[model samples]
Target: MGGKSSAPQVVLADDNSPTPSLPPSTSDDPTTSTASQQTTSTEPSAQLRPSDRTENLATDRTSNPSSSVQNENAAPVHTNQLQLPQGTQSSRRRRREASPANSREAQDRPSFDSLGPQGETTDEPLPKRRRRDHMMRLEGDNSNTNGGPRPFTNGSAADNLTSKSLNGLSKAVPAVNGSETINGHAKKTDAESSAYFGHDREEVSRLLIQALSDLGYSSSADALVQESGYDLESPTVAAFRNAVLQGEWADAELLLFGDRDGSEDEGTGKNNGQGLVLAEGAQKNDMRFWLRQQKFLELLEARDTGRALMVLRTELTPVYQNVHKLHFLSSLIMCPSTEELMIKAEWDGAHGQSRHILLSELSKCLSPSLMVPEHRLAVLLDQVKQSRIANCLYHNTEVSSSLYSDHRCDRENFPLEVAAELHQHTSEIWFIAFSHDGTRLVSCGAEGTALIWDMQTLQVIHTLSHTLPEHTQGVCFASWSPDDSMLITCSMDRYARLWDTETGQILRQLSRFEEPVSSCAWAPDGQSFVTGCLYKERNLCQWNLNGEMVYDWGRPHRIQAIALSNDGSLLVATDTENHLHVYNFTTRELEYEMDFKVRLTSVSFTKDSNYILISKIDGEIRLFSIENRKSIRTFAGQKPGKFVIRSVFGGADESFVISGSDDGYVFIWHKENGSIVEKLEGHRPGCCNSVSWNPKNPRMFATAGDDQRVRIWCNQTASAPVLHRRHRSTLSGPGPV
Candidate 1:
């Protein structure tokens, strides 16, 4: 229907309507009306309005005499029925008449579809009780037709509306209540979680205690132990430590040995008679000796020379069986003043400030399994932190700070800028050498100048030049004597001269060569040295301290580089013929020879004298084993032969090979694995020709470049910080080759 039907139907009574009379019982029974018939319509029914259609269906049922009995028993139809306006009825009638069977079904059923538009229905059956109850709810009248609510004749609009309202109310009510309940539950959960963690407080306390001890915070550790009800040291150990700290040497010894007589065992006959027996063990003997030695030093510090000699003879002499120990103790008597004694012993200060250190050393003699060390936990944790820092591949820091829970090695600090620059060289520096004592450094350059630097001050203490007849052209190479008192420099001027480092005076001059001296090295024995000549005469000459040539090998190829073994028994040399030759100086014969195929720029020996480091012009550095005569490893990341780039072993236990790059960078590679570890970029505009690691300090190194600058790299967080002036100026020039 175009609009809802206004016509009324005879069905259930409204309050204002009169009650309908019941029909008399019939002989024939009516079949149950199928809900499916509601949607089917006849042509005559569609031509009329909804009220007219309802009346037509009822009249058709009553007129048929065969169905009259069934019609009388059927329930009365509701006024609510599918209604169509007059305009749509004609078109609908044409479609309905086309389907006669559907029209007949519509005439047979009551019109419950009057409630709303007839929606499509599925073939599935609905449960009797659920359907009946649901229909009763939608009817708005609770009165039952036959003992219970009537079953729905067809799916109704009221049923869908009631179901949706019920569902929406059910969802909305719980959602509001659930939010409030969840918030209250969360508060209770947090309270319970806090209580649970309270039980772990003791473990947290223990960890804090451990951290304090490891960091050498003794005062803090003691206070924490008292507050936390924990004991880290036994009473005897505490007493002994206190005694050592207070410089009560005799009391410390008594505590160590459990003896009342401090001197009776040594036959001095002095005793306190407290009846304490001395602990007897080999370790106790060493502890007793250490105590007596410390006491002797105290006497020396007090200028009680006569009593110190007595203690040395009566107590220390019997215990100090090692010759070195005896000599060290005996030398203390010769010191005329306490200041000199402190200096000689390398003590930190006077007045027994280092007594605790002495005690720490003495405790090491005792068996660790039976005795707790003074700072055992602290030392172990410190070691772990250091080891982690040394091996860290990333996130490394210069200092161990609170930023990292575990110590980190900050890689950014590396390839670090120079802490100090040696500026005396007026031209490009060619080579650098450090003395065996690590107290001095010598550098030679193309400016015909050779300068000696005091390692402590970073200042030039001496300079050797052409004015002294050492070189007429630029000095190209330099080496230090093993004793550190004499230095030798070779120049393009064709002569190699030795100079006294103290006076900067020429000690001796070797006979002038036909060609320039290219390279030189001092033998480990300090008796002789070797020089390699360039161009004119391809000879490797060995000379003694008297400026006399002891041995000379004239090879067919030009000698480029040479190195002497630590024992001075073997010499390894590289030549222009692409061959590496090893000779025994004692036997005066070539021990071995190997062909490299490429030009060799430099050669060096490992500290153990078992392997050789060979730098080649092919942009590679190879480690060759002397025993196996085979290549062990190859390090890359640096292009060789832009200048004579020298590479050497460094880092912990010589685990890294460090070299200068032609690209203005210093490259470090793991010696064992040959992996690039660092590419330090500080040298600018030209190649870094040489790098030298300080023999005394593993973390400090120096690099020189064609820029006429000598840069010193030091770890700022190291124990002994280096002194330097920051230079922001750049030098522009070509460096020496």
Candidate 2:
């Protein structure tokens, strides 16, 4: 026993005591119950043994255990003594040593059995509050667990469990500030509001009264119900009921007067009581009859009338009148389509229902176009019913069905975006002309090809590709004679060829233009034509339809384009300079010459022959009155780059002017006002060369652009009608003609 007593005894002393289960700690320890609760989800406790706590307490001597321990018999310690001195290292060490044990005890011990029965052993489950706190602290300490020995977030079961629990808890909480529940405020929907305010007396009454104006009800209804100190409900409801139930006015006065508190004098002159009684009486008398009559008209409008008695029955009693009024109301209630009205009338005749009488009453106001003509009533009856009949009746001729049917013919409508688009083609489409009557449209591009299409159908009738022995190069300038009977085409081969429209056979070929003919124009009479060369000063060469070079407006200032007026007297030619020359074809002398500030590309007389529309190199259009030769309006809508005006033309009445620009927009404009009407934007990246209006329909026209696509526009309706692809022919291929 003495030898055993001499052996060393290890005493484990925890100077910084572990937390007690029965009560929460009030110490300044990091693992203090409150801090432990806050940090539990984000950080875990670093567990240390009691021996380590003692060693830490030894180093932190300032954390006096004697002062911290609260004995049951001892008095309270001062608050200053509880506070650690100015956060010293000893105080920190004492806190670290006891923190894990304090948190662990609080989390592990349960409320009921935390302090065991002997006040010695603790076997209780952790306190729910402490356990929750500890779990939170462990949330952020993902690295605390090492591999199997250390728990990986995804690899270990414990870590995965923690993640799942935390995720579930997060989902249970709502988003902080979302639209549906903005800052926790509940929202209301349109459906909910509608449910609370459905159609009722107030709503229905408003709707009925407003329908009067919308449905063409006469102002008499409003006038009779004027502020006569009478409630609108009794009169309105009474009026409707009388017209619906009783078909006569004998009771209308009585019903209207029954509710009156003021005008009750029985002996008062019958017509002296503000005339309302009489007016109401009058309305009551024929309203049902009129409503029934209205129904007949409605039948006429719908063109259907089901089998029913069309005659009015009168038995001099208030009840009969009300019934008649109800009959009238029924017509309105059963209103059908116009066709059905006629059917209803026919059916009524078959059913032995005074179809003749119904037609007679309705025919007084309705026209034969809508209602049968046999129903004409007597003059007196017609006069008596005029007001009521006029209010409800309409003739088929009076209303319109003027909207044309699609079968007639459909053309594309191109609403222009700018004033005009000019130079409609770059190097592709070379020849463009309107037929003599301006009906058939024709275009010939670089591939020796020519296409003729019906302007209305936009369907190509012929695509002529002629193989000629001598006329080999692809044609450039092609023009239709005034009669449209002959077409003359010229090319870079310095040769002009004329073709007979009926046979497609070459009439003749004149190889006289020293340079390539760049442009051609036929004289007003189909007898001769003129051609212009690009570089030669002697630009114009005249040849008869038989390919005879009969006349020459020799070397006209390096002419680029030429146009002849309807009269063979005037020919306007554009030279390389800013000047335009007008020549007297008969006199062979210049009539007038106008100088332009910018290079002029193309020019044409307005449809009325009142003004000249000129296209310039800068992509601008200027309107000049032929009489004054002075500019009237200038239209510019070219994109921000160097561009040329390819072509210019005017609608028949000079209402619209169209110009093609290098930027690929066909600008349509109001000729007089110079206001942009619409822009036909269709061509890809190329100059729009020429545009011509359909002489028959001003709304229809054709445009040729460098994109090798000739598009047609019948733009009378849409804002910007789509371009109908009329013809797409390649320019690089061998000449078709």
| lDDT top scorer | 1
lDDT of 1: 0.59
Score candidate 2 by lDDT: 0.46
TM-score of each: 0.44, 0.39
TM-score of 1: 0.44
lDDT of 2 by residue, 257-305 (tens): 2212223333231222111222212333332344445344433444454
Misplaced by over 4 Å in model 1 are: 1-415, 467-472, 535-538, 718-721, 724-737
Report the number of the highest-TM-score candidate: 1
